[model samples]
Every structure is written in C-alpha cells, then in structure tokens.
Target: MMNIVQMGLGPIGQQLTRYLAEREGISIVGGIDPDPNKIGNDLGEHAGLQKIGVEIAPDLDSVALLDKADVAVITTLSSLKKVSPQIIEAAGHGLDIVSTCEELSHPWQTQPEVAKRIDEHCRKQAVSCLGTGVNPGFLMDYLPSVLTSVCQKIDKVKVERIQDAEPRRKPFRDKIGIGLTEAEFKAKRDSIRHVGVEESVRMIADAMNWQLSDVEETLELVKADRDLKNDRIDVDKGQVSGVKQVGRGYRDGKEVITLVFKAAAGVTHSHDTINISGTPTFTSTIDGGINGDIATSAITVNAICSVREAGAGLKTMLDIQVPAYFDEASP
Candidate 1:
C-alpha cells in the first residue's frame, strides 16, 4: 500500500482526501494544517467523509507516523517562495512531493535560484517533487505542448478558457475579484490576478524550443452590466464582476503563444478553446470546460504514484508521464 501524508486541508486539499479515501491501495496516513479549527479534527470528517482514523495535526512534525508515508500531496499556497521551505522539510522526511502551487509549475523564468535550490535539495534527499494543477499544469501549457506533437511545424498557438463564477466555490469567486469596484480591482491588479500565466507560457516555449524574446501577462476587470448576486458574493452594476487576463509569449516580436483566461458572474456556455497555426492547423474545444477544482484535486492525486516512481529532483508535469483517473486495489 502507498501511505500518503496530506499537507494543507483547504477546499482543494479536502477534495483530494475524499478522492484518496475512495481508492484502494492508498492509505492517508496523516494530515497537517496550521488552522486551529482543523488541527485536531479527523481528516476524513473534515473532508465531508465519515470519521477515519487519521486526525489532522498542526504540522508535519506533529504527524508522528510521517516516516510511513511514501509521498506528500500539498495544496497550501500559490507562491512557490512561501511553500519552498515546506517542500524541503517534506523531502527531508523522505517523501516524494506533488504540490498545487502555481508559481512552482515552471519557475525557471522568474525564480531560477530558488528552483535550483529546490532541485538540489530534493536530489540530495533522494525524493522527487513536482507542481501541477488544471490551468498552468494541463490546459494552458502541457496540453498545448502535447497537441503540438502531431504537427510537423507550428507557427502560433491560442488558448482561451471562459467560465461562469456564479456556480463556483467561494474561494474561486474571491480569487477572480468577483465583487470589487472598478477602482479597487484596478489598484490590486497585480495581487488579485491569476498567478501562473507567465509560467504556462514559459513551459510551452520550452517544450517547443522557442526562444521567446518577451512574455507579458495582464489582467482587466469585467464590469457587471447590472447588479449581480450569487451565493458567494454580490456585485453592483458597473462593479468588477470578473476578470480577463491575457498572457502572451513573443518570438522576435511575433506572438507565438496566447493564453486568455476569462471568468465572470454570468458567462454562459463556459468552454475551453485551443487553436493552433501550423503546417496542418487545427482547433479543439471542450464544450462545458474542465472544472478547475475537481480537475486539480484529481490530477494531484493521480500524480502521486508518478512522483514516487520519478527520478529524484524538482520536476514539472513535463518531466513525467501524463496522469489520469484509475482503479485498483493494494495489499
């Protein structure tokens, strides 16, 4: 059986625990979270499952059976800098790691030194570490790269993901600046926008061996046409109801990769569209789009075994085989 330690018990983490519980051959050995409310609670119960034996501890050090785990699934924070220490600590305890931190998806372009440190440390600890999620991990970067494999030549690539925020969870609503005024949204653009567009651009460029001259990421607020209210938040007419963030990768002043992310309170017919320009160009679209939360949790759990079997080092989705849903039992 593959023993696992879960770090971060937030919405996504909880979803992961519930998914792990349904699978056989995998045991959730322990859980760690600093939240006072969750520190002593049963991990399974907190995840909306019947009480299981594993209780959440305040930290990894508090999980006395840490050594029994073969891997760690982390969904704590989006910033790689803030989460790097936890990664090193987990690796030191001999656990292969799979994290949902966006910035770590592909850090070489912006945080090379820290990425290097992580790679070196993980190598020394003889454990592998990877960062992944739905957007930066799959749809925007890795998936586009994979699609390019069939193309004999490629020129430009465009990807657009549009979703309705009304049906999303509170955290998703909050992250996309759902109910802020136009001025407030403009002032906090840098802090409020999605975190990994540039990283996704970098990953695709690396995959295609493109020498990008410049890469740019920008976010614009989508004002509410009229008053909008959802279970999560309220938006006044003319207030920022959503966001339109675009990331572009330029090769010698020519745009080669374009990624557009749009989410709003009432976007109808949510979908993901990818178009490629090449010797034999094509376009692919998912009718309803992939659910970010569910896909993130599924991919994170699906990747646990891949991380364990991977070579020791800091890795990205590109460094391993594709992850997918599975069914099997263990001893």
Candidate 2:
C-alpha cells in the first residue's frame, strides 16, 4: 500500500483525505496541520469519516511516520514563498509531493528564482514534486493543451470559463467578491488577486514553445443587474456580484493565447469553452462547468500514482502522463 501523509486539513484537504481513504492500495499514515483545534484529532474525523487512526500533527517534524510516507499531499496556501518550507520539508524526508497550490502549478513564468530553488532542492532529495488543481492545472491549461494535440498547425487558442458562485463554498464566494459593492470590490481586488489565469497562459505558451512578447491580465467587477441572494451572502442590484478576469498572451505583435474567467452569483449559465483557431479550427464546450472544490481534491488525489511513477524531480502536469480515476478494484 502507498503510505501517504496529508498536509492541511481545510475543506479541500479534508475532501482529498476522504477520497484517498476510499482507494484500495492507499493508507493515510499521518497528517500535518498547524491549527490548534485540529491537532490531535483523527484525520478521518476531520474529514467527517469514521476514525481511521491517523492523527493530525501540528508540524511536519512532529510526525513520527514521516520517514515511512511515500507521498505527501499538500493543500495549503497558494503562494510559493509561503508554501515552500512545507514542500521542502516533505521532499527532504524523501517523499514525493502533490500539492493544490495554484502559483506552484507553473511558477517558472512568474517566479523563476523560487521555482529553480525548489526544483534543485527536490532533485537533490531525489523526490518528485508537483503542484496542480482543476483550474490552472487542468481546465484552463492542461486540458486545452491536450485538445491541441490533434491539430497539425496551431495559430491561436482561447479558453473561457463561466461559473455561478451561488453553489460554491463560502471561501470561493468571498474570494470572488460576490456580495461587495463596486468601491469595496476594487479595494480588495488588488489584495485578493485571481490565482490562475496568468499561470495558465504561460503554461500554454511554454507548451507550444511560443516566445510571448507580453502577457497581460486584467480584472473587472461583475455587477448584479438585480438583487441576488445565496446561502452565504446577498447583493443589492448594481452592486458587485463577482468578477471577470482575462489573461492574454502576445507573440510578435499577435495574440496567440487568451483566457477569460467569468464567475458571479447570478450567471445564467456556467460552462467552459475552448476555441482553437488552427488547422480544422476546433471548438469544444463543457455543458455544466467543473466544480472547482471537488475537482481540485479529486485531481490531487488522482495525481498520487502519477507522482510516484515519475521519480525524483520537480514535475508539472505536462511533465507526467495524464492521470485517471484511481480504481479501487484494479490489480
């Protein structure tokens, strides 16, 4: 069985642990979380499951089972700088890592120095490390890149995601500024930067080996046309419902890649669309949109075997083979 250590017992982390527990050849050896309330609690209980005997440790150093772990699934903060220490500690103990940190998904474009340091450290430790999730890691980047494999020649690519935030978690709704006024939204927008569009754009450009002259990103408020009420919050008409974020990549005076994310509380339809203006001009749309929280946890859990198979180095979604559902009955 694959001995796994779970880091961060937040919503996504809890979901990931639950999924991992259901897999046949997997064992939850330990858990790491700094939350005092969660410390000493059974990981299964934190995940709303029957106690599985693994307790949450306040820190990685305190986990006696660290040396026995084959992999560490980290679902902590998004910043590479903040999450670097946790990743380093895991890799130091000779454990492969699969994390849901968005920026770490493709840090080469925005944080080359930090990426190099982490890559070198992981390589020295002889453990593979990957950062991934549903948006930056898949729908906006990896999935779009996979679609382009059929094209003989590619000119431009555009991906658009429209999501209704009403059904999402409170953190997600808050992150998108669901119920803020126009002035309030602008104030928090700079602080709460949208995590993944730029990374997705860079990942696409790097995959195609296109030399982008510039990558531009812009965020604007999505106002509510009428009053809106959701489980979390309410918004008056003309107030901020959410946001529209766009990232564009240009190469030699031409825009080659474009990604647009529109998420709000009252959106009529929630879907993902990809348009490739290349040979055969392909366009595809996903009917309902991928659920960010659930899909993120599923992808992180599904990536475990892939990370183990890809030995000893810093890995990305593009570096390893595509992942699939972990069949509990598989031999």
Candidate that would win on lDDT = 1
lDDT of 1 by residue, 118-145 (tens): 9999999999999999988999999999
Worst 10 residues of 1 by lDDT: 322-331
The local distance difference test score of model 1 is: 0.90
Residue 148 of candidate 1: its Cα lDDT?
94
lDDT of 2 by residue, 35-101 (tens): 9999999899989999998889998888878778888999888888999998998899898999998
Which residue pairs come into collision in candidate 1? Answer: none
TM-score quality measure for candidate 2 = 0.97
TM-score of each: 0.97, 0.97
The residue ranges of model 1 lying beyond 4 angstroms of the native Cα positions read 329-331
Whole-structure CA lDDT of model 2: 0.88
Candidate 2 stretches greater than 4 Å from native: 329-331
